[model samples]
Target: MSSTQPVESEWDGAKYGREESTGVIFGMEADQVIFIAVGVVLGVLVVMINGFPWGLAAAIGLLIVFGGIGIPRIKGNSLIGWARIFFRSKSRQRSGNDQFVQKDDGVEIGFTDDGEVEIVEGPEFEIMDGSVRRGDDTPRDGKNRIRPGKPVRMSLPGEFGELLVYQLPGGGAFIYDPVLKVATMVAEVMTEKAFQLNSFEEKEDRLREWVSVQSTIARIPGVDIVQLSDQTTMISGASIRHWYEEQILKAPAVTTADGETVRQAGPDVDPFMHQSLVETIMSVENQPVHDMWMAVVLSKEKLNERIVAAGGGVAGFMETALSMMGTIENAIPTSGAYVTKWHSPHTLAARTRTAFDPDSAIQVSERGEDGVAVRQAGPMYAAPRDIKTYESDGALHRTYKIAEWPHSQARLGFLDKLVFAGDFRHTVSLYIKPRDTAKALKANERDRATWSSNDKIRDKIGKQQTARKERQIQDLVQEEDEVTAGHAPLKLICVITVTAETDRELNANCADLETRAAEANLDLRVLYGQAEEGFIAGALPFGKLEV
Candidate 1:
């Protein structure tokens, strides 16, 4: 009489799953070196003791220490996390899959095969329209299990155009095109072309002004951009030559295809000797890169409302649409500027490829389970299990919610230290939801009225009115002016995610991040129960304030 109940074994993370994740000490696993050192020390003592049995005892102890006990955990966390990371930092990693999704704090890292690593928020959520089925029912690979439906419903009820938001597992969101950003960038370039600033600083300032202009543009409301990054070892000199030979040279006697080779045809064989030496020089640099992607998102309903406000009649709507089109089209470079195409339309497959295998040409419709069904969604699974932290794919992750913004106001570019921190792996994201101009104006007026009412009450109670309220009044005045001048108002949310190979490293990184936050004048609070949701809303590829 045997029971058929499944044996509930504990999650033994020590069971090596991914060969590449096996951590190292200096250049190798710390276990072997530590074992050797222990044996030597014990042998010396045994020799001093002058007993054969003592030597045997020492040998037995060595076996127990080295073979029996692997890397122990410090209260359920990796004890040798630091040593392992030291080795990983010095070496390379190869994954069979195209995408490796990892999350730490408010940062979610999506690594693609093409060396494009994106740090974003919001874990991908299955489509609510019963399109993406919850996968753990059978043996199937988790990659691309949730296929987005064709003719996906536009969630934001905009008059002009719709905004599409994809909720990822890590609480990061991916958005459709943000019209205002396109419009603003075009506007900035045109303004710069009209006036050629001399220095880089001038150009930067001009761009900064354009950024300000973008903040005020009301083309689309509830808009936000999600950014992600992955650290890729830069191409080596030898690898570059090999790629060049394969991709460009083709065969010895073949005439080169145009743009195939860095060296042009005829007399331009030598890249250095050619007229495009500057371009060659620019292209020659090979190094490790932290790839970055900024995804634009906006609300559809708000855009349509703005369009409706432009005119109720069809002619007026058409006129407004044409004007918006003109703004985007005229924004294109007509002069000697670089031309870059927008990303492909296969958003789901494209994102999957970026995350999984860079070379995959799999269509979105073709993507499905790969014979290894997941029990529960990874990021979404571990979060609720742990109170203080979440662990996934052998790495510990936590979410840091932005508790406070800068109290002492700083100028633009104040985040230089935190953003440009060269050491460690991390992701920074800002979610900006635009407010409609008319409603924003009404809110401002209501706020002012409320302030007046509060000020009288305070005066009657014999309390001194604070400077903060006064400043608010001043801010509203400026805000009104900017709105009148076609500037947009946006609600902003910011978060940072830090990644480490183990718990020890994670703890150390938390300290460093805290210090950086203090310097940046940001108050980052570790999310208690909101780890999963925070990652989706703040760190994924799209920004969803609703999370």
Candidate 2:
């Protein structure tokens, strides 16, 4: 062990560089094959020249050259060339440049440069660097993330390339080189449209059908009618049934000595009364028809009787009874035709004055349809003429005759008497006026003549006329019976005079009086004018004309 040989680190060039020892060839495989064939051919030539059999050696040399290189070169080139062709054909088949498809895994997709898509089994595939070209130039820089399920014409990060990596439903997409991955989302487009395709005639037919149904339902007897809309209505038959039931229930039940109670017999009943009751209850729950039944129950006479009994007659029963009576009266057709005749002094005056025409001195006529005849002064005895004047010793005297004979009595019928017998304050009025300046001056003679002529005279005359009219109106204000019973009635008449030019100031005063009377619920009437004779005539019985 101590005597072990030293190890050498450096090698001699002759031993390492020798061609036979190194087994090295300088040229390519094809060239080497050619050189070895050439060397064998030269050896064969030397062997032939040295007297060996030439034909066999040359044949052997040729066989060695062909076997060593020619067969392998042809087979290798053929396999590699076919492989390249197969790869390109596969790539083109999977290109999916212009169509869309669903993948087997239902996720991964492929797209081509021509905006086509192909859903695939695995992830998106990308072309390696410099493997695809833009026009004639191959790309050597950058990588593109591709969407397999989308169109291929979609933009990418790098220069124009054949492939792109895209995300699937569950996984992501990545580029081939650098192996970088990125996520993607599938885009969805949606659209909606609305249209009115019905014709006007179709709509009109529907409307007509609705109206026919409504009219038919409205004619159903015992049903309450209610309009819901222009084209719809609700008819309630439940109300009549309920009202019938309530009446039957309250129609005086009898109790026997044996303690058995008996109810009044109903108009009719079906075999399944319980079912009918349940059905009615269910049907009326949500329906507005129930309200009609409620009204019917409330309006029943027995229900009202019960209410009156429970709360006593004074508890709103009078008002309820009055309202019900009014409703019933209004419902009767004959009640609307009833009328009460109104009688006033004007009517009596016209009737009485008819018998005194001037044309007939002994006029005879029947008083009315009752055929009572009346004889009175005729028109000749009633017409007035101017006063005749006689002059003697520079003195003139005048004589005047009566214009017409006033009627002392007038006959009235039962209706006329009835009208005058009640509410006289509302039925009568009086108007007064002064006849002459002499009477006016006499009323105001205590004042200066000028002032009396202008204001004082008119003022005093107005006050007297108002007072006298008021007294006469008061006398008529009570009913005839009441007046006979010695009760003084209201003085309801008013009078106003304008001795001055303006009547505007009187309007407010009249309005105030009218308003006060209205607040007190009085029936006051006012009349105005300026002649004393006319006023007296108007205040008397059988005064004024009636149409």
Candidate 3:
């Protein structure tokens, strides 16, 4: 709907950030310089030996050395790292278990390639009747089993009590606690419903304003996680038909959820009304659903430190453990055991035990059919059965990456249609991170300078002129004004998750999502082979950037 204006950032200058990094010497890590030097020497020698073959080899070596391959920078493992995997012998590399790597911050941590922090398992420990005890296989008194009641929003790894933070398996620090997520979510839904009552222009203005605010929210501190919230809506033609038939049969006596007889369609109801209602429901975009997840990542090392620091270390750590449990117990509303995907706070030793022994993965769960708050051991871990399409706990899921944003500036409420568009169940989340104001200004200035230089060059070469450069200049000036006024810029990413009963249904739903997203000024690209990680980054409120 709008023309390309280069003022808008493409990928938020991830490469440019690297260029500006003052880390190490001249924005390059020591490891990087080593790779470059080695590549240069070997490549040049090869070139001297032959000619074309050597030249091509040297070019490739330089590219890998500089990571000149593409944008967004490499996520994990530099280009040289890739070469090492193939070229170096496995025995030459040290095993992750052999030693702890000290980080720049001076914390020792064992890291997996995925970036997840390795949990240090402690000796088997337990609490019996509120008294401290040790030994893993000891019979448990059922009093402290986990219960599924009102869900609690917990700061991650901290919930495990043994850890204060979880340096996400990826690169980033996340504070898992929600300052005000629930209330904000409720308000957003309510506001959307109320928007239908507004005038067209007023609604447009409101939408644009809201979009601006989302930009701001993304810029907040430690807010880089991609958020995805999932919801299910039943709006199929069949369901609509059932409801319509029920209404027709109970016409003039239609009842509410409470069974109160409400006014119904008149006795002379038009037969075509059913067709109209069905069409409306089927055509509705967005298929609005509540209850979505926001992604959160944990600072793993901090969590471990907190756990070890509690009650003044090993001498009084037992008392500290009991005291920590009491404090957390008071915080959570549910009784029995408290379970999380990673570890259970009620069972601190769960992670410690599991770390030492992976065989004992079972935890206290909603055991038996009655579903009472029972203290019974069961497996709650949902290990996916497949990679292409993950099937866990009877649900087939897939994730879509927001590969592109609207080229044209859109109205604020442009997404309202997408919110309730198709007849499906899914989640749409925005992972927002605020960039530092100074950094934002610097990036903006650099981009503007580049554009200005290009404009000058085009003029010097007597090339055809276009307004693109001029528009960029104007935009840069406006952005500068905004930044000067203290409005920090944000780095934002969006994702969508589609759910279905089976593979076929999932594909169908994904198609529907893609179509509806286009209508809503969105461009969704299926994550394809990367469904699980994408789902975790997008669907959960954990602020984890998909590194």
Candidate 4:
């Protein structure tokens, strides 16, 4: 067999668009403007009453105090704004809304460090004539009972409500909304070629294939592509034991001519040999496995159209979703490395549970079971943020967003080091939203004009333009040119979440991630107060909607 080869290709530099604030005049809010106006009016009154130069000085002092001192800038917000945010956070903490705890029995919920809940028993219900009704013999329908032949409602975290997820056959997840009929299908992407290309030709071939697929997907309206990288360390003893059991169970056996059973020659007959084999397999435990997943979210209209075309029903939903999966598989040929398959409901639940609580252990058998969907997939306990980290189901997490990308061109696989550097468990999620070509071009042109206008204004004011500002203009021009040349424009957001069992371990893993990210020419900024939202965006595959 031929050996696999490495692949390399240069990548264009990236930049983030600046967020615009609309309700501001000269970088001041309406409240600040009102305060200034009121102060100026009071100062004029003082001038009218005192009628001297002292009154004029008092008016100027009032203006300075109201506009300068009261609105002193701290970071991006004024002092008063920061105070309001601080108080709001404190209020949430005091109210215990930021923490949650649920029992396995789904009864008597309680907060970990604070908060309280009172469980009240309610009247039972009964199913009569295929309709659930109250047991009181009154003609009242049971409002909460789950009816048959309808989509099951899933209990999700607040940020992920109005969404339901089910696993497909192989190892894929289908997240959908009952009301909207929109769906996001996720499948594991085997990208070994990314790190195993032998020549520049191979790189070009791969790029061509990827771009061709992207172009096709972009043309399909109401479809969005999201790429995610989920990295986690193997659970050593459990996996080894499971593998060893499977091997012994599947060992070959033969029946003798006399109707006596005979074991296969080697390990089946030798106990010592089996033990040695088990030990050998256990040696590579705790290895890091980095998995890439590609998800496609179909808009409600597109999905409804597919369902109708397939002759609507439960079967129609299944067939339509699978047909879409087939289309994706064809669009991006897997080269026989991996087949695109949907996740079974059980597997979907396990995956979501792991997404929210990375420390949870999921057995191999759980991935193939066809049992009822796992209803309690969320974490048993969660503290959204303790200032800098979020804790959920015993794991402490610190999440970071890419504040900036490399300012210069670099190789495509530059992120390999960051993804596989440390053994600690972490997740790197990349959310890519395809933009309309015409709209994207128009936006870029607008941005270019705005930048030019701002630069000219600065020059007229005797202020010098920075090198970074000049490079930004060039970047926009290059982006516009690429889009004009048939390249699809996309909005990409990346977040990384580091998971650990303890505070110390969490900190160390975070530091390692920072160092690796720096090495990869990525600027990472900690989520800090937004750890929970960051974790969901970084660690969960369902972040397609979040992004």
Tens-digit lDDT track of model 1 for 401-472 = 566666554434445445554465555665555676788899778656666676676788898855655655
Steric overlap count per candidate = 65, 13, 47, 10
- Residue-level lDDT tens digits of model 3 in 1-547: 9997644332232110111222233234557666566666766666776678767677667666455522112433345544544343222223322111211232222223233454333212223443334222212226532111112122111112112222111111112222221111100112233566676655555645554545544443333333434344432344444455666776666567887775556233554875677777656433333433333332223234443554222212222233333333232222111212222222322222221122332221111111111011112332233433544335566777665556465544455555555566666666655577888899888766666665566678887654543544565776777779765575656667666667888888887777778887676666543444555454434444452
Pick the TM-score winner.
4
List the candidate 2 regions with Cα displacement exceeding 4 Å.
1-245, 255-257, 265-275, 284-547
Tens digits of per-residue lDDT, candidate 2, 26-84, equal: 11244444656676776667667655576566657766654554324232232333444
**Per lDDT, what order, best first?**
4, 3, 1, 2
lDDT of 1 at 117: 44
Write down the lDDT of every candidate, Cα atoms only.
0.41, 0.27, 0.42, 0.61
Which candidate comes out best when scored by lDDT? 4
TM-score of 1: 0.46
Overall local distance difference test of candidate 1? 0.41
Once fitted onto the true fold, the runs of candidate 3 whose alpha carbons sit more than 4 angstroms away are 1-43, 51-189, 192-197, 208-230, 233-289, 292-388, 447-481
For model 3, give the 10-residue run with minimal summed lDDT.
181-190
lDDT of 3 at 506: 87
- Please identify which of the two predictions, 2 or 3, would achieve the higher TM-score against the true structure: 3
Q: Residue 199, candidate 4: how far off, in angstroms?
A: 4.4
Instruction: Give each model a TM-score.
Output: 0.46, 0.12, 0.46, 0.72
